[model samples]
Target: MDVSRTRVLQLIARPDFPEPYERLAGGSVWLAEDVERWITEHQPWKADQEAEEEP
Candidate 1:
């Protein structure tokens, strides 16, 4: 979650990325659990990100 808004937008635009769980008044929303699962399966950098999160 240290990524920029632009990076997040890029991920959201990916064809294989998970869709938003809901459409809100201002924008879309996705469940954290779903996003995490998708990241674990598809993002190559996920392991590195997890390593960075650990103390």
Candidate 2:
């Protein structure tokens, strides 16, 4: 679950992005649920590696 803050902000700012959940702050839209789903679906390998590394 490692992500750069700048990249997260960029994804939140993209106009054509279809994100399921959103929040408004300082007149900007932020996508939270979409990022969660993206991390779960796209980073399966990372999760597996992390699980293996854990006790």
Q: What is the TM-score of each candidate against the true structure?
A: 0.77, 0.34
lDDT of 2 by residue, 1-55 (tens): 4669898677556665555443466454536666545546766686577667888
Global lDDT of each candidate: 0.88, 0.61
Record all residue pairs in model 1 with backbone atoms less than 3 Å apart, i.e. clashing: none
Error at 46, model 1, angstroms: 1.6
**Evaluated with TM-score, which candidate comes out highest?**
1
For model 2, the local distance difference test gives 0.61
lDDT of 1 by residue, 3-49 (tens): 99999899999998899999999999999888888888898598678
Question: Distance from true position, residue 17, model 2, in Å?
Answer: 6.3
What TM-score would you give candidate 2 relative to the actual structure? Answer: 0.34
Worst 10 residues of 2 by lDDT: 21-30
Segments of candidate 1 deviating more than 4 angstroms: 51-55
lDDT, candidate 1, at 29: 94
RMSD of each: 1.8, 4.4
